[model samples]
Target chain A: MRNSFKKVYLLISVLMVVMLAACSEDETNATSEKSGGPVSAKIGVISYMTGPGAAYGEAITNGFNLALDEINEKGDVKIELIIEDSAGKQDQALTVAQKLMSSDDIVALLGPTLSTEMNVVGPEADINGIPIMGTSTTAAGIPQIGEYVFRNSIPESLAIPAALEKAVNKYGAKKVAILYGNDDLFTQSGFDTMKAEAENMGLEILTIETFQKGQSDYNAQLTKIKDLQPDLILASALYNEGAVIMDQARKMGIDLPFVGGNGFNSPQVIEIAGEASEGLIVATPWFGEKDDPKVQDFVKKYETEYGHKPDQFAAQAYDALYIMAEGLKNAGVADRDALRDALAEIKDLDGILGKFSFDEDGDVIMEPTVLIIKDGAFQQFE
Target chain B: MLGDIINPYHLQIISFILINIILGISIYITLSSGQLSLGNAGFMGIGAYTSALLTINFDLPIFLGIILGAVVAGVFGILIGIPALRLSGVYLAIATLGFGEVIRVIFVNWESITQGSIGLSGIPHLGRELFKTFKLTGFDPDMLGLKNNQFIYLLVVLILLLVNILLVWFFIRQNKSRVGRAFAAIKMDEKAAESMGINITYYKVLSFTQGAILAGFAGALYAHVMAYISPADFAYHRAIDILIFSIFGGSELIWGAIFGATFMTILPEALRFISDYRYMIYGVILIAMMAFRPQGIIDVSLLKWFKKKLKLKRGGSLGIGTKKYN
Candidate 1:
């Protein structure tokens, strides 16, 4: 047997040695802070850069990169980003948030991609008084973490109601079947919003079914919905499952207008569901076909830069950075407390997402464009 | 006596290591008896949610919440252990794995209480609020330096250290006692151990409960430190990770858990220098370590080497004695 007391002492000594060895390296880190910008901030980004959610993270990064170029060229805010991949895990997100919070120079943080991550990272950043904004975290109750927490992406609580109302108005439907992936926070929150809204609008509930994500067989749930003969289907699911659910419903010879929440705001639904996507409807704060010159300019610049059309994820992230720049410029200092105040006070900010403002809860206040899938492409729902 | 000026980044990492060490030792308790129970992660979940909810809903003291959390998990350990008495080897592993899944499903489906998949966030920052900011005030750490988070992290580390010391004493003492010998006998041959009047059922259930209690505490500590948790954190992979900690560290001794957890936790941070390739490299390193030292980092040969080098009247639990090695 080993000596317990002496081993404990040895453990402490070794840890102390590690600390001393670490301290000797001089914790002075040279930042990428450029000279001569009235608005200077170092922002940290935690994203799912290499996971299944990498598309969202990559788009956000691309958007930020594009926005940074424009802002730096204008010579107003000089921002440096220390981006870390969270790999879609909350623990990793928390770790990176702590890492970012430790540094005195990083004035702001952004984009943990998903609402679940923001649920973890948001509070930590808030306690530390760092302003953290989510570009694509659209689930409900994110900003409730603290005043420092903000999300520019429209939450499902708002987006779902709008889509459902539009679908009701168009289809003149009185009864609807709601389907959602039960295992995800994102989908659950969306489903909650849909249920509340459907009840509020006095639509009769036909059936509600829950399915697990990554499980392609939705026959069990769809058959139940099919039997109800509901006028429409309200779905809250990621693209992969959403597409299959739609495709399966169509194959089962039950074609009904499908109203989807924020998760359906992607081209993958169309790519996967094909003809079933024709009547698919979703509400979003952004669309590429807006007739505004500014929108065209953004889309053109984005396409040229990345060789792909910038989707809502890229657009929201693009607008989020611009919004941060505005907040920094208005704050007139790099202080986080001052930045939070300035961000809170922001109103009538214009970007690719159009006129945006922060509500009292730091959630985005903006009008969303309701869109419908027509001929395998997103078109304005008239 | 170097001045204690450390960044929150490093402090956070060290905190994780300490928390993981608690978890490692937790599983080590179960493994010490040669029982490979995988339900520890589920027990951890039970503890984390219980503590988090108690503190969040009832405004209980953080300590009370944590203790209550652990106690609730221990209760569950008793429940699971009763059923586990009939199974062994892979059957026990599968049963425990199923139990873990059952716990996760409960957390997910019980949305009103568990918050579903979105998880519970903004749980009180325990250490931060618990302790007053201490200063090496005369020192020149002007991070408003080390005045706040550093003290918080230090206290959390100290808590983990205290837990560690307590476990070391208990485990070291237990290892030499009649109960420890009974465990060894049971592990070697259950029939023979039972024939020797060892009371196999009692000891087996007792080990499971002890594992649950430690895991529950680890869970409480993790929830408070990170201030966030979800069903996802305590999934099947987590159960596997808890098992890997003891096995990789060398299940032959308790130090194996300590050293194994420390090395594994730090390995990821150390590999951060390699960026994205780090996880791949980490996998390779683990594979290499296993290939070379399947018995673990603290095998019989290493202990023998330590014995020869220390040259003491008798090497105790810590492997450190009053004698000078050099």
Candidate 2:
């Protein structure tokens, strides 16, 4: 048995050596075949398509796929999308990013949903000189990763101040309570911005609380917040926890209007929190109720296709694909560096997200519309 | 085929398989001595973070960082093993699971160094730095008539591959030693081994420390290859994966761990075509594997059965022996 095992091992080692040589030759042939006319720029997306964060993934896929179909039909500059599910884990996201890089020949990458996954996947794509754009990664320090990384999603550092200012003025609230998820980069950055902006406006912070992502019970945190009796609540959390916190807070009769970070832009908060979602406010680049012809067309088309209205995730993803399409058209070739430079040079373009453009640091520069949940859908705060 | 092998993405996967093999063996070392730990991932984290920090902060050589990381993990193994060794079976598992969580919590809170849950990226990768520091001018043998320039990257991968293969072979052959027997004796009957003056405590701790060192080394390589390390990477689930690599591969032999690590590492990526439902399929396969082969995918009994079958076929074909082996 031992001898047979040794023989088998030797056989495998020999086979491996032969294959390695064969593989190197195979690569030469492949490179030589790439001298043809430009093909579609293959863009890969890493997303939280499963696990607890699947809602974002579902919306992103719907939005992008709808956009992809329209863009491919237009035939200006052809594009193909391949999305891999990260399941909200950093390791899985890294593996998927590598897998896409190795096998698919993706010209660019889009997202892995959360900032944590982007934190892992961004540098990898950048290191390999792959143009990676983020649709929803809003944490601080992402643009600082490398030259190849870009994000269309507004970072919390910019969004939270606009949100706090709007909510305070509209509600005439004096004292505020801040609640956030401490473990995640998105929420932590949002909380930091919220605190600074709140103090900047001279609003007294009555209390501050935090919870980890995927934690079901926010009762303890809400109980403490209730005790503080702040006139208004400020929260930075993903839709999953944000809804539950609002639900439980309303149940506890703390009934003050809540101002939130980017995570609350999803309509799933309305679905989950139900009646309690009323008076919840969030600043967003993409508004489903926008009166613009482009925005209305998307909202109507997305509703017909998906049987529901587009949320922030859907709208941003829709815009993301369009942005990439424009970049592909300008570059006129499906190469990484050309697409990256083209994308960087984008000054302004009309989309669902308004005049979308990449700033010098590759972060999005756009004004946000502060909207409050009224009746059911989000409405412009008066 | 050769082209696919040279793809940086495929090379990365190959590296992960190699790293996971060491991790599988890490768990195997403890299990062979009737010891159970669900904390190999924590040890791996220790090695990764320690090595990563040393390299990032002090600009130490990668090799030195790896060695220091392994040492720290080994010391931790002894410290943890001494107290935790008193418990047996499930209790030991629970205790070690707690150890993994504690390590993760520490990593999450140690924001200054670890950079907290967001982790640190652009971590001076091994391939880039190693190639820069060491020129393989003479070493780049255009082994199969490939271009020397193209083969440089392959040469680095080949070196790492050869080293890992040797390590796997060493573990496979190491079971014949006296220490291996001591482990076997302790597992079979602890009291009997103690009666024979084996100093069971020493042997148990030795196995634990060995497992930790191996995991730590793998972690150091993992840190460099992934170029990113986060607290979430070493959570309780990852420890479960290390244990699964041993159990699913056949914990009975060292070969089992290697097979388990290789197969399991490849399985998820192999199922990548399934897209959204791949993880569900992965889970289903695990369930099916456990149901059909409870002893694992590789074991001594299965090998012996194969050998007997081979012998019968050979004898029958040659018409040399008419032995009626049922």
Candidate 3:
């Protein structure tokens, strides 16, 4: 019994020591802000550094870190960033947000990757009075969660109409079959926007079929669409499922031109779909091929550092960090409320995404550029 | 010194641990009767949504909302248990698992009610609101300039303590009662239990329903504490987590469930330093534990040793403190 008690005590002590070590590690990181700095802003970044959304998370992290490096090197204002991984889970996102709010003295929070997660954590940030800037959350009603919640990414409601109009006018699309993943907030909202836009554009509506996210088999949906013989298929799916759906539809001999939502704006979609991805059109806030020097510089620096072209997620994240920095400079005080007000007041802040400004609801107001995949590369659609 | 040692972050983690302990114990109630259920999370979801809607839409008091939520979930539990408890072993597990999926689908598709996948937010903080309702200005930590989370942590710990006491009492009382023997008989041999005039079906369903009620109670508290909950929060993943907690702690004793839930909840947060590799390490630890100590981290031998150390009397009750059964 005495021996067992000794073992238990030893085990507890080891655990306590490990926990203390972890706490101390965070403390060191927290205090590592450049000393002798007159003005320093501590920002917390919540990204999906692991899980299904890790790819986007990594891009956001890389973008933010790159911006951090450039800002610190410039030496105008020192900003300390503490990055936490939510792993694309709402509970983890909330936990990290709470940790950042209660423990760390953060002026702002950034990225969370998914709108679903943002919806969960956004209100908490609002209650805590911390400004949470979502870089990639584009679903509806996100900014409506709280005044403190903000997103630099353009919403599907604003971007999808332009793309639908382009599809109708440029391609003479009349009959379109709509396919969307009903489970995801992003894709479902995308489908809603597309459906609304299609109705407004006076396009013939074919049968609308829904599938769950992560479902690979689309033969049943495609077969049904094939019978309808629509001119185009409107797909609202992430790159992984979008690639499969396009490939499957083509293989099934349903060679209709596809118009996709924001989720289809990825190199992975083209790489996965291969020849099938040709002529697939999407509307996005950021197009890497833009001749604007700011866009080119960001793409060049990102490509040089990450060994690949920065996707929309990266570009938006890069701009998001810059926006936060801009807000910090504008507020001139490292206070949460001041930073939030400053972020809300942001207008015509030109960055990679072009003349970015936050509307009254904290949603980005910007014109989306239409692009189509040709010869395995995204180009401006004429 | 203790207050200085534990910061707000640690308090938050502790509150989560407490909530999970409640979940673990909820699953343990069903496992005690040898009914392997996987629908506790569905019941949790029902409780969370019900309580959240009540508080957010109707302006009901937080505690009242939580109670009503649990009661509503309990009614649904009975509804599910009547049909699901008819099956046994893996078949019963599958039925419950299917029920959990159905609940998820309903939550996702019923956009009008649940706000769909976008999820419901702006859930009022329970601790601050409860303090305000009671007019206990002095005891209200939020009013006293302490963080709202600290008050919530204290509330959660208090609830955990109350739950532990209730579980201990229920386990002790039930073990001596006729219901406990009937459950043991059904688990040991359904035919024999039937021959002994034990109503196997009734006991099984009762055990399942009771387990669901506990889970719902935990869920209601969890929703209020977190101040936000999504349907995805109570998916099959959460069911698996609850199952792991009960099994890893050894379902035979309530203390086992407590230890299992507390350890598992805190382990992930503690392993956060590893970041991406944390889940990998967690899987490894689970495998190691199962391989080495299949009976669980808290087994009969440990309980026996503990009882001896405390000089507790033997054989009065068949609850966690005693070693009458494995």
Candidate 4:
């Protein structure tokens, strides 16, 4: 029985090899045949727009879609967006990146958003001379992705300093406890950076606690930190863990100023943590309700269309798409080199997140926001 | 029908299937010995990262890098197996899971060596002995080289076929040898086998070690194919998914492992058309498959009986055989 199945498996493998080679041959033939006229502009998106990171993926797609809609509506540059899901799986991200690179239409790529996915997919983009702009992934050393790789999202290294500065200066918090999710790349990097920065800022790190991602109870970790009696708690975690940590800390009767990085900037954190997140402070690059007219218009449009206020994920994604489209428009041609030039030339374009600009390394040097959660609503700092 | 056969997407699908077939058979080696493994992904990751790193960072030949990657992954598997020998069942599962996680974490954290989760990029596209072919042809292979993924997929399929034939041949030989009986005896009842001088611990350790080696091969190929590796590629969830594939396909059936691998790999892609509903369907299908055909789709007599009832001739030259282990 095993033998026959093995035989079939072998047969299938053989058949697949022949078929795949044939397909590649066909694609080569087709591409070779279409050598003249205006080159079709290809915009590829490698996103986690499905699976465990579905919400974040959808938010990114929304950003990409918003940009495409505006670009296509104007009809200045002919562009085609070919999207493939990374599924938050690193291997799939690589596969999708390769598949996209194989297509001549793909001049540039947007992202495979998660830090891990970006890490895997970035190589292909660099090898193939495609520029990739990730919407949101704040892990340290993102600049190392490649010369062609660029991310507009503020790194955790930049984002954490703002929250740490607030905790040290505003709250007069001499002693701070560090809590973070271990499994998440962003959270881990943020926490580690904060730990170092906090120590460097002459603040005592009374307790450092870690919890795995997808964990519900932080009582053990929280209990250890609460016992340390730190003046403030700095948590580097996403909405679910953030909410749980806050809720659990409050329930445990530990009243101290709570601070977090970009992971803390989510409505779901407030919704889940409820009253516990009321006085929480977070450092973010962009807020849904900004003073800028452009940002306000976006918030208004997003709220009306989605029937809810957009989170930081959606806001950043929206801005990323706009910036990408602007690059395409500026390039005035479908050529990758030209599109890269267009991206390089982008300066002072008002995006939902603020002005969009790429440095030599393709990273946007954007200002960070320090927001406070006042009664369930995010109010900008004075 | 011809158009369908000639479609580019179909070819892509076929390529994917081939890749999965190699991965499936590689996974089957461990499963057939009644062991559960999650380290295949880790092995694949090692292969991918090592090959990519070698080609990109060191300017090594792609084919040489691929072989080195396989060897490296195999060595890693053996190393993991040595420590993992102390565990069994869920304990063993957790150990292997940790093993996979450690590989990913190392990949993510070791920035100096691995570019620290940004992924080692710009892997030269060629695999196995193909680099030599490229050198011989002097065809400016870098510009017109095979896509790394496609090459890896082909290599994986070819290796899988060779491995499957070898495994079948080995097992068939073993079926007539004392070693096969000892393994069978151990599988049936460990204490009894040990009492009968079968050296259960040795065999169990050997089983896991052998499984790990195959897993490493798969991992190496996968890494080369993808030309990238990150923590997310070989998470705890990945290990669980592989175990589920083995269990769902049937623990005793060799081909079941291959079938399970293909089904699991391609099922998600197929459901991708449904978007949100795809995961839901996948869950439902898994549950249904578990509830109804818990032994898997490869029950020999049942297949023959069903075929007879349907009055259909068994197509192809492949003959059905009885299960000696059972």
The residue ranges of model 4 lying beyond 4 angstroms of the native Cα positions read: A1-42, A172-174, A199-202, A223-229, A251-253, B1-27, B35-139, B142-178, B188-199, B227-232, B248-250, B301-326
After the best TM-score superposition of candidate 4, give how far the Cα of residue A327 lies from its true spot, in angstroms.
1.4
By TM-score, how accurate is candidate 4? 0.78
For candidate 2 chain A, the 10 contiguous residues with the lowest summed lDDT are A24-33
Q: Provide DockQ values for all models, in the order shown.
A: 0.37, 0.31, 0.41, 0.17
Per-residue lDDT of B79-108 in model 4, one digit per residue for the tens?
777677566667866777777778887886
For A190-276, candidate 4 gives per-residue lDDT tens digits of 887888899899998888887877898888888888788899888988888788889989999998878888877788877888888
How much TM-score does chain B earn in each model? 0.90, 0.88, 0.88, 0.77
Query: What's model 3's interface RMSD, roughly to a tenth of an angstrom?
Result: 2.8
Least well predicted 10-residue stretch by lDDT in candidate 4 chain A: A26-35
Off by over 4 Å in 3: A1-13, A20-38, B1-7, B131-169, B312-326
Best prediction by lDDT: 1
iRMS of each prediction: 4.9, 5.4, 2.8, 6.5
Off by over 4 Å in 2: A1-40, A102-106, A171-175, A199-206, B1-5, B135-156, B306-326
lDDT by residue for model 3 (A1-382), tens: 6586547546756875786566435653444343545358889889998776699899889989988898878766678888888888776787777778775567889968888788768877887789999999998888988899999998999877877778788768889999998887788889989999889888889899989977979999999999998988899888899999999988988777788889878989878999988878888998988999888888889889999988888888888988988888788777889889999999999888889899998998898999888898999987
**Worst window of 10 by summed lDDT in candidate 3 chain B:** B317-326
Q: Which digits, one per residue and each the tens of the lDDT, describe model 2 over residues B208-248?
A: 99899888888887887667788878888889999989998
List per-candidate RMSD values in Å.
Answer: 4.9, 5.1, 4.1, 6.5
Taking chain A by itself, what TM-score does each prediction score?
0.91, 0.85, 0.93, 0.88
